[model samples]
Target: MSRLGVLRAVCVAVGLLPALAHAFLVNQWETIDTSTKRAQAAQDVQPGRAWIEPLTGMDMVWVEGRCFKLGSPPKMEGRDGDEGPVREVCLSGYWLARTEMTQGQWRRVMRNNPSKNRKGDDYPVEQVAWDDVEMYLGRLNSFYTGRVRFRLPTEAEWEFACRNGGQQVRYATGNSAEQGSWFQRNSGGVSQKVATQRANRLGLFDMSGNVWEWTQDAYDSHAYKQIEPQNPLRLGAHPFRVIRGGAFDSKPAALRCSNRGFEHFSLQAANIGLRLAAEVEKPVKPRPINLRDTLL
Candidate 1:
């Protein structure tokens, strides 16, 4: 047979084979295409509390967890007494608000204005105490069908999420202040609207500056040194809670992910606001069962 004739015969055989098993072949291709589509759809999905209902109303970003060195090195430039003795810490996955809680979100949930100085609906809601935030979360949880809950991130979780699952960067986004953080060099003397600055790699907006975020754990400068890697360490049953990320009025050094501050749970400040954390849900596995033979 000629080479061209042989090639045509091979093509005819291949096409005829598909016709012989058309239904099975079509079903297999459909399954493969469906799986591929599902996987592609998952890639577009964000992680953590952002996937839950109530918190989903606000734009949130996922922070994949890992072990990272926490705190400042002794030789770091402009190091402060509070940044302290460096240490290693491990974190679990979490979601953080893309921006500080805006007055709009606060009003939606709490239904009252607590901010002493209201700038605009989009501005970070300030003058909220830690206790007030907890109260707000309680109400939000009830309003959202009880499926989702909200509370402040623990100190370690706050820092880990703010760092966007990476080691300390000069600012939360990166080393450059020109990247739009409201710090000493660029804030121009006042707090700007939330989300006005560049977002961190995790898509969390205004992590470096806007307003300081209240953390669930209490403050202690040496707290990290003694905490277990599996669990975040909390200082004594103190009235004060940790606050992280610098405010609009802060200097560059203050915005470092390692920097820490403290305030009483009931104390409200113009530069303070709250971001929420909720538990991550894991897929439930089905249990295997033994079926004994039964007589009918």
Candidate 2:
């Protein structure tokens, strides 16, 4: 049988393949306002040289890593107690996805429809639990051959990438939602296409207002307060993993770059989807570090 057919069969076995398929094409830049010439000019500038690649059957964005503040400051409006006190964080170079996984991409790999309401290929694939994403990554890792490995971005990485390195104004696009985002003021009551929106300084698309993306760090209301500024903690073994970016149904407040939320790994929700990450490759020797010697 063909690969697509095999995938379909797998979806059926998992009870996630829908009987009928529908296509949902979104305009990647549906909500961008053209009136602001200055903002438009900024948007025109190239975000960066980073490009996306499908690794392990998953689409990922190459992130040229650096450092940044890990949490929200005390005086920002609508600040959550958990978001503070602010701290610094440093990250190694890595790659992340431009947007969350879409139905088309998920079907290509898992051949399933975990979304409660099936949308078109371009719509973010929702209803996937965090643990399910881990399972997907396991299969994806097996599918690719490379030094880089697939996983989720940490909360700090997600914010830093969303903010697009240091050009942070607010919301991935500087200080205005009109530049290239779908929020309560716009969005036309639905999610638009994937890449139509304006990309961040790093050339990442849909980082602010498409869907909330899953991150590697587990949720702890006060974790950021005590953690060191450099090399922000990415404690994945803990319960309640973090999810970033606002979803289609969220209001403007929730779509802010620093906004945060969490959900259990097994509770699938319509607003949740994911982005993939791969570690930077380093030269390897087959037996670089002997396990016995390291143990000593």
Candidate 3:
């Protein structure tokens, strides 16, 4: 018998074909979506808990809102021209995706992927403009029919989460450097798979470095001067929009939690991608059962 024929016969005799077939079938989203495992993964979001969003299977974490400072302190190292005049910020609790939106999730919603890397489905989608993201969010929101809203976080919201829900961390990983992310020092000039690094204290990944994340706010160097104490969102004064988190090529200074960057609203580059956020209703607390109530 030929070598190929012999190998096939040997595999069949060893009973490896069925296992291989099962693996292949499970990898196909459609085939396994009906399976119990996939259904459990698509459960509804539970307030005050982490769960996979059914529509996109995005893992969302709850961020309890609080009031905190909004910009770099005057004496902070790596402070930038635009990251000063610190202001107090108060925000409401919300749900945020644990990692940047992946190419797989983008393709699932938009039916097309625009990433320049094209490395894998788990890699963050890039080369998408802010306007393009608006469209994506529009479609994603339609799935809920107004029950929930999904969009890019505002500048203040992004910073609040990156700082570990406003507890005063310098980097997104809650530290000063690349201890939990891919950046210029170790990125090898390309994007890597999501969640490849350690998560920050908030259970978020790549908060310090990865790709620059697009936010909902527009650019204004002096926005901090007029900052609001609650849910601050700057819009409609310039063509540039706010982006946070440094890209793979970014230096440590640019990766500081308070460092700010912006680009033309129409600009789309390999180093720019996004995550998602949703304003969620506060979860109601359950009342305790009391045996004395029956006697009463």
Candidate 4:
């Protein structure tokens, strides 16, 4: 009722506004992901050639095909129940982006940067959703005249690579999260430039933390129970898609190779981003009747 009381009320409201605004932005991203967002590659693309997108400078790294154990060991500390029954999975060789897609790469393809940390072009681009990534891939596919096929790494592929093609290290690189990953205790509350820390044995950087990487699989609590031997349960319909590794704000426990998290298909948060996985082209072989092929 008094002038002083009204002034104090206004001051208090103003003080609360920033926190409320941040929360609103965090909650605003609530939508499902789409799987069929990419256009088919151009018919003339030479399937087996190593090609580069001119704008992004992203070099695709080849991960060889193999049978590997998937999921955390039951007795491993910080392992979640959902990460079991620790089945075996076999996968074909494929290409994956060597680091999280950078802001420069995203901007070159999408014409805008949505990352909260705009400190540099090399910083991992965050604030991206699965749907947004689909659009980016659609455009990226078109950019290379369909010669390049890029999509999110499946949860199995991601975990396999983070484990260094099945070496089974706790984090992607080593036992100590502080040495190889950027998490709450080390990241200073923001994403740092990629490749600044030590890389994994596979020569991939930022696989444990920095930002959570989106995968192609839809989130399902029971899906792991029905595991197939090869490329299991990648395509599907679900409310949320899987996101793995962890983010700068995460604690070390979340950065383990088997730790899993899910986000609504459309929820783009400051700490969520993506790495790219590519479809592999089977090598063409000459027919047995060909004399030259047999000689080779």
Best-performing candidate as measured by TM-score: 3
The alpha-carbon lDDT assigned to residue 81 of candidate 3 equals 79
Tens digits of per-residue lDDT for model 2, 108-188:
566566875465877778888889998988875554344455788878888888787744456887766667776556776
User: Model 4 off-target regions past 4 Å?
Assistant: 1-52, 281-296
Stretches of model 1 off by over 4 angstroms after superposition: 1-56, 144-147, 281-296
TM-score for each candidate, following the candidate numbering: 0.73, 0.74, 0.79, 0.77
TM-score of 1: 0.73
- For all predictions, the C-alpha RMSD in Å is 20.0, 10.7, 12.7, 13.1
Where does candidate 4 clash, by residue pair?
Answer: 31-266, 32-265, 33-265, 42-146
| lDDT (tens digit, per residue) of candidate 3 on 58-126 | 888888888888998888888987997899989888888999999999987776788999989999999
What lDDT, from 0 to 1, does candidate 1 have? 0.72
Query: Could you tally the backbone clashes for each prediction?
Result: 0, 11, 0, 4
Measured with C-alpha atoms, the lDDT of residue 114 in candidate 2 is 81
lDDT agreement of model 3 with the native: 0.83
Could you tell me the lDDT of residue 245 within candidate 2?
81
150, model 2: CA deviation in Å? 1.1
Per-residue lDDT for 1-296 in model 1, tens only?
99756765786777754454554444443221233433433444455435523322566566677887777888887677767666677777766677788887897666566776587888888999988998888766554322334568887887776676756677778886568688767776666788887888777777787788998888876676677776476857798789998888888777878778889988988889877776543546886654653432
Model 3 TM-score, all chains together: 0.79
